[model samples]
Target: MQTQKIDFAAVQQAFLAAGFDLVGVTDCSPLTGARLARWLARGYAADMEWIGRSFRSRVDPRRLLPGCRSIVVAAAAYEPGRPPTDSSPGKYAVIASYALGPDYHRILRRRCREAVTQLQRTSGQPQKFRIAVDSGPVLEQEIAVRVGLGVIGRNSLLLTPSFGSYVLLAEVLMDTWVKTPEQKPPSRHICLDCRKCVQACPTHALTEEGLVDSRRCISYLTIEHRGPIPEPLRPLLGTHVFGCDICQEVCPANRVRSAPRAPFLPGSPAESRYPSFQELLRMSPEEFKEKFRGTPVARTGYQRFMRNVCVAAGNSGDRSLKPLLESLLSRRGDDPLIREHAEWALEILG
Candidate 1:
């Protein structure tokens, strides 16, 4: 089996034209998972057991695509605009910037497939390839670092010089070895003396060593956790209904003057980004599905979303929400998850 020489220049142009803000190639060397093993061993991954289950495939690309020799990593920048402000504190819910648009998985996967097709045309031969857009077991940030895309920040996010930590990552794995440009190794000391993200986290989820305890992470609790949120963390969650971004919001590295508008994920309207708490509390299952159908928030499902809304309403400190919370408790058929949070909110309001 002869390996084909892929034109690196052609590949870059294809990805750039496909709307990727950054693109680089690196050899498919096996990555060391000692750090990941230790992180999991200490139970930092929380309830995401799949991370441990797919440990081997994450550290080695060949495990995902046998005979893989090279990887093309690409990044798309999204605007990390300021969190919406309202005169009324508890009137609206806060959402992470990433989930305010169309799902990245579908967008990146389509763009990656397009680039692969362009590369096949340029090379004049069909190449075996696999596309990963955050769903696959591949460790995207590690590959991005090797490709000179960015350094992992103290918040445990990839912070690129151009877009800071607001870029989405995707990768294309190929069987044929490609010529990659010579580049300096990524620096590990980018965040020296920086503890803004660690200190700013309301839940103290980050460590000085750049590892995150997902169990204490607000984002994980709001979006991933299925059961009732712990009593102590409820007030700390504030009004964040879907995900939290306090860590990224306070990172010095993320203070870019401007970010490239994500071509795939168009800017959502203000109503969508900071939805009214009253509307969300009264939203039916069908309304929830219709409102968040294509966005990442839909992944939480109606039940958990209601649970988050109840928590947010409880923490709002607004007495106006007391009536809605009472209504939720009145429904005997309502999920206990929702009822529990609603009852907690009512007590707080009293």
Candidate 2:
């Protein structure tokens, strides 16, 4: 036990030397409290039934792995620093900044594994270590905040002062014990009745007291929803093709001082803060692959992405592109989801 405490502290210092901007460790006991239930009661998670599974494990990292003692929280920002390109109607669509580089799952998972290797070497105690990034049976944001990495914002995202919630979080859970850092809980909740995120949300996702309704959320509709996007939320989608950033864009936190938390964040400037729609519709498969080869958008496949493009194009209401929208619409005999949105776009355009 004593050896574990000493090794844990040393491993933490190593994490810093290894280039991690944020790290924290805490006991992995399951939280038996109202917060967990409240989070679920609000139904902010949407169709992500997986989030509802392994009920006991999601709240407690220790429950995630047998004999787990401590959890090491880690987060790396992925802001890519480029603004969205302006709208070009149906010919183009704007992808989120985080998707401009290598997939975060790969990036964060590798870094987490490396941290564990360093821990195992220096601590001289070999044990089970699992890495989780939006995976694992643990609640990342809740546990991250509990461990003093950051405070939860009204948007229900973990908001670090420097990274402004544009970060990917992961955890290294192992049976090896560590000297958990002593941190004063956050002094204040950063969001102060800041309705910017709530008001700016293209869809009414944010609700009372940090609750988010993922059903109406653009991120959910675009990526998680396999069927047709409800007509009510389509017009609210704005020009975002892959993910929506309107809420984050309007946050006062994003406007504050922020340096890139990860080394590879700088990139060629985006065409505009909002990419033109025309440029998106005209993006060839080759060009799309070249530009976003290792990006998160690759998971959705080209067909779904182009389908989103058509929907965004029709939303632009530029009657001049009616012919173009018609041409794209003609190609969609197999995908009812794409066809349905395209048809709705035509109505909005006319």
Candidate 3:
């Protein structure tokens, strides 16, 4: 049986029409899992043990899809028009730009599927494909770099010529072998000696070039960590109630941003970017669901979200939040995680 020829040009157009800003293709060569294995051995993944669990599949594309031959990497730029204001005492909390809108996982996955369907129609053959939108074990950034889409910066993010490091990546692994154009190797000087991202991290999570200690990363603490935040790190969290963006905000590569062709999701309200700490403190579980149902913030769940709000409130040094902290302490049914952080915040305010 002859394999149908894949039109690479048509493939690019299909993905671009599906809302991706950048597209590239590469062969499915197995990646050395050494770096990832070493990082995990050093416990850099913190409590997110799933990364280590999916080790084999993550390093080999064939493990994910039997007979995988080529990979289609796509990127969507989400850089905001303006940088978010620095969080301060008694002010609106800072949220990572990526999480401000509707969830990218669903948006990118649907778009990837659409692109695959279009490819099937254009080629007149059924193509076996799997879509991975940050949810799969596939090494997306590595694959993106291999396809000439971008280089990994010192901050460990894909820095594209047009979008810098402020883009979301997705992959379409297919059985159809697509020939990719030969590409010049990306320069190693993308980051140079600039350590702005490292210096800007309040928690010093960027311990070395392109390496992060997840235990100290604010993003990990706020979203992934499921227990009491270490007391010392609590103060460093400042007014951030969700994921942190300090590293990306300070990177020089992100300064000259390109306007995204269109937002991946509908424009989120201003409230999502600059949420009031007071309102978050008083947010009921039902309110939390209604407000963040389809957004990344919803993944934190009510208890953890409120726990983050408490830490931010405490850091704000805003005595006006005293009553709310007291109320949390008064409730017998309040989650201990929330109460512990609330108590710490009350102490900070006092």
The global Cα lDDT (0 to 1) of model 3 is: 0.83
Ranking by lDDT: 1, 3, 2
Error of 2 at 254 (Å): 2.1
Total backbone clashes of candidate 3, pairs 3 or more residues apart or in separate chains? 0
Tens-place lDDT digits, model 3, residues 33-52 = 76677779888999889999
What's the candidate order when arranged by decreasing TM-score?
1, 3, 2
Candidate 2, lDDT over the whole model = 0.71
Which pairs clash in the backbone of model 3?
none
RMSD of each: 1.7, 2.7, 1.8
Candidate 2 structure quality by residue, lDDT tens digits, 1-350: 35456454676676655556778888877766355567677786676777667667776666668878888887776554464344344344566776666787887888777777776686665478788888677778777777777887777778887788777787888787776657659637879867788877768898757777889887777776667777777777766678777677777887764665456444725763345666655566676677667778788776677767777777766777666666666765456766676677777788
Q: What lDDT score belongs to each candidate, Candidate 1 first? A: 0.84, 0.71, 0.83
**What stretches of model 2 exceed 4 Å from their correct place?**
1-3, 7-9, 32-36, 84-92, 266-268, 272-276, 282-291
